[model samples]
Target: MAKDKTGRLHVTVKTGGKRKLSSKLWLERQLNDPYVARAKREGFRSRAAFKLMEIDDKYRLLKPGLSVVDLGAAPGGWSQIAAKRVQAVEGKGKVVAVDLLEMPEIAGVTFAQLDFLADDAPEKLVAMLGGRADVVMSDMAANTTGHRKTDQLRIIGLVEAAALFATEVLNPGGTFLAKVFQSGADAELLAQLKRDFAAVKHVKPASSRQDSSERYVLATGFRGGALR
Candidate 1:
């Protein structure tokens, strides 16, 4: 590692036999990313913690004494932040995380190895939470197929499902936030959110790579009850 003129560390990975150029480039990017280094030093699970931190700083979403539900919460970075902000560690609030993959325990977060897409997931999460949630957040992304259209569609489907689940589980005037890509499918989702929530907006945190199309849809002030 060498320091550049701008005082940023630059790491170059040597590509050899069996090491693809893409993999080498990706490793180099990760090695040089400030957020990745910060996450490691600060004990967060992944660099994605910064993204949520940035968003919440601006939006004031997470608060003490609020129940939060996190969907697709593997690796638990977002859950870690949620738990801390909501004071779940001190038992002032509740944070429940669900993912298809198993996650290690966080002090205040309850982990569930369940798929959010399952028919029973919403009910189960409500039961675990003991009531409707003050906020429902999802950082879920579908497995990419390498094709842009297919990947966009899959991600949209996941966001749609997450939105429906939020409607079912969020308390009146609650908030819903989810990761979404810049794609045509977002129009319909935005329209639906507008109807269900008092305010809806899109946010792209500075922590997110500029080249990535990923953005978060934030909806607040839920109308409550079933969507017509």
Candidate 2:
């Protein structure tokens, strides 16, 4: 009923035997989520903006005029923030966003409706960029099959693909950020990133829901020593 400075609301909802306690609580939480309201007010496509905000605030990414690619940018919340920041610099900047689902337009952003896993996806992205990018970000999560191991593998597969594509498209000193489940990143994925990037760190943003198993991996300073 009331919202505090933290954007948390003490919402009351009657379960009425229609739903489980967890389901009712989750619905109520989403309904009263201040970030949701803030996103609506700020014209963000999803509350995911806060997640990116928290990440950038901590890591100092999203510089002005930087070239960036937003993978799995269906709702375009992360792209929205990136577009604004990158547009602030001279000579213009690029924010190329792609997703399997159609996204409503956001100014200063280029949207592509295509599956990132498609065979020609990397080529299409390269054509759109006309060059390498400074940052590559992915919030892609596979449609969960409810089978823990299967879902983990699916997400890891996507993350791995995104990571490989980043290696192909990112310039020297570029950064890669992607979401991953708590099942932990695959060993080969970590090994590849460590070899290609100067540093890799895992981060959990504060805006992320406490119950969510999602975390982000930030790999920065691409070696680019072998990209040629």
Candidate 3:
């Protein structure tokens, strides 16, 4: 490891033994990533916590007394920030985290290991939240195949599902945040959101890697068109 012009330590991971070149490069990037190190020091589950932190700091979307739902919230980084901002552990708010995989417990977060696409998911989440959610956020991404178009379609499908779930579970004037790629939310999706929300925008936080195309689609001020 050596310090670069940015004064950050740069690491080199040589492809040793059976390690592929791609794997070596990935390891090297992880070793040199500042957010990864910061997450460890700050006790956050993943570096993704900083993305939500940065977005929330600017938007003030999370607040005390708000009810929140985290879709596909494994590893619980976003949930941690939501809990703190919403004061969930203090009983001033509620946060429900749902994922297909089991997540270790997080303070002030209720974990549900279930697919959000299931028929009863929206209702179940609203019940867990003790009322409609003031915010529904998702950091979920579909596992990518080598095929770019297929992967993009999968991601869009997931985000669309999350948005629909949010509409069903969120309170009037609520917010929705979801991770998206460089192509951004599809035009059709954006049009629907424009009708449902007072504001909709695509945002990339400083914590999100510039090299990565990942960004977030934020929609606020829900008009509440839930069917039962």
Candidate 4:
């Protein structure tokens, strides 16, 4: 292991017959990422846990006795943070995580393997939560295809769906947070959120890689009722 001038570790990926240049570069980046190291040392499922931690630290979204719905929660990093902050492990609150893929058990989170886009997803989530949620958050991203425009559209589509779901399931005075790319198409989504929530803001947590275009849309103080 070697440390760069900035005191960050520098990892070199040796090229091999089967390894493509892109894969090698990705491996190198992950190897040197401080959050990845910290996640391993701290026992979080993924480095993404820090993104939610930073967001909640600034926004105070997670609290004891709050009901939380985690959409597209895979690998369970965000769910882990929510469960602890909301004291779900102690039975003071609830954390319901939904994803297309199965996740291993987290002490206080109830996992469901279902697509958020499905017709019955909202109702199913409400039933699992046992009522309206205090917070609905998503860290979902569409599978990238290397085409910028197509990728941006896909990202916006998912965030829009997640936002619509939040409005339906969130309680009055609740919060919604979701990841979005820095795409211009987000304007419509922002407009809709502003109408449904008292305040909406864009946040880029330090835990997120600076090179990534990812940003989180945070909407607080839900006005409640059905989507307009």
Candidate 5:
């Protein structure tokens, strides 16, 4: 894979002998996906990088030298982008990336392998940063159980926990972005974000696959409301 100035990745297709239908379909899709090609070309670990980039481009959450936290950072796509931009700016910028899976090393990014739901996780993240973060972003999703309601509820739980964590850790005017579902965020969660942030909006970036129901909630301008 190689990248161009526009951050587009180009990958060469390799033909492997006969494969299962699903595998073949997946391979074909990957070969044709512009985001996947762009990611590879640009040296990003995953195609999800475009989602964060698009979101930031619209909301302007990313700033040089600002502390940022990335949750569910497996493969470190978002962290990679954040690290590159933040490191370039110098200053006090830092990125703390956490996931249950190991991520390849990236300059200027701290990786932690731990469950965010663990009681000590927030403290661990804060300790790593030495301070609150300017941005708290989460792409965490519960493993789908194939039951629609069950999956949605479990994902909502994760988002709610992430939101609560943000309430505790975000600096004033901080931003929070979390992946949600087509059903949208829970009413209570949306209400809480509205109370805590100056603006709360839901967005679906074009980079996100059309068939996927995934959406994102972007909360900005933290008000430092009651976290506990």
Candidate 6:
């Protein structure tokens, strides 16, 4: 370990190992990331818990007695936080989480191994909540292909699907929040959101990586009609 320009001891990975350079870099970043350590210490599933925590702190989106749907909720980071905020443990509220991968159960979270993009997902989620939801949030990200434009479009497509699902299942005055990246291609999504919601804006939580272009689109006050 040697002190870098920031005067913090930086652990350098040996370059000549059998590991690929990309793998080595990723391991190094994971090792150095404070949030990753913090998450382990705090018993949260992943570092992504803080991103949702920060966003909820500012927006007051999750509330007691509110029903929430979490899309792409593998490992249950956001679902954990949402379950607590909505008081799901006491049965005052509800949190329904779904992902393409199996998630170990979290307290107060009803989990399903299913893809959010499926045609039946909306109806399934509404049934889980026993009705409409007060909030729908997605942190789904497509696998990165190292091609910037292609990767951006993939994530945008996920956000679009989540947004449309929210429009279908959210109660009047409900909230929709989804992860998106910085790009001009999101303008059309924003336009659709503005038509369906009273307020819409982009949110970059402090917990997000500074070098990353990742941001979230938060839409509030659902007008209730799912605009086609």
- Per lDDT, the best of the predicted structures is 3
Q: Number of clashing residue pairs in every model?
A: 0, 1, 0, 0, 6, 0
Comparing 3 and 5 by TM-score, which wins? 3
Q: Write one digit per residue (lDDT tens) for candidate 3, span 1-228.
A: 789889977998877799998899889888999999999999999999999999999999999999999988989999999999999999998889999999999999999999889999988888787778999999999999979899999999989999998898988999999999978999999999898899999999998886999999999999976646
Off by over 4 Å in 4: 183-185, 226-228
lDDT of 1 by residue, 53-149 (tens): 9999999999999999999898999999999999999999999999888899999999999877788887888899988899999988889989988
Worst window of 10 by summed lDDT in candidate 1 = 181-190
Q: Alpha-carbon error at 15 in model 3, in Å?
A: 0.7
Q: Which of the two candidates, 3 or 6, achieves a greater TM-score against the reference?
A: 3
Per-candidate TM-scores read 0.95, 0.87, 0.97, 0.96, 0.86, 0.94
Q: Write candidate 2's Cα lDDT for 1-228 as tens digits.
A: 776668766777787766898798888877877788889998888999999999998898898878899999988999988888788324478999998788998888999998776777777887888778899999888888879989989999989999988987798999999999895577889889999899998999888887788999899999974332
Point out the higher-scoring one by lDDT: 1 or 6.
1
State which candidate, 4 or 6, has the greater TM-score: 4
Candidate 4 lDDT by residue in tens digits, 114-213: 9877888888888898888999999988899999889888999888999889888889999999998875337788899899899998899999997988
- Candidate 3 local lDDT, residue 158: 89
RMSD of each: 1.8, 2.9, 1.1, 1.6, 4.8, 1.8
By TM-score, the best candidate is 3
Q: Flag clash pairs in model 5.
A: 2-41, 3-41, 8-38, 9-37, 9-38, 9-41
Q: Where's the lowest-lDDT run of ten residues in candidate 3?
A: 219-228
- What is the lDDT, from 0 to 100, of the residue 58 in candidate 6? 91
Clashing pairs in 4: none
Inter-residue clash pairs, candidate 3: none
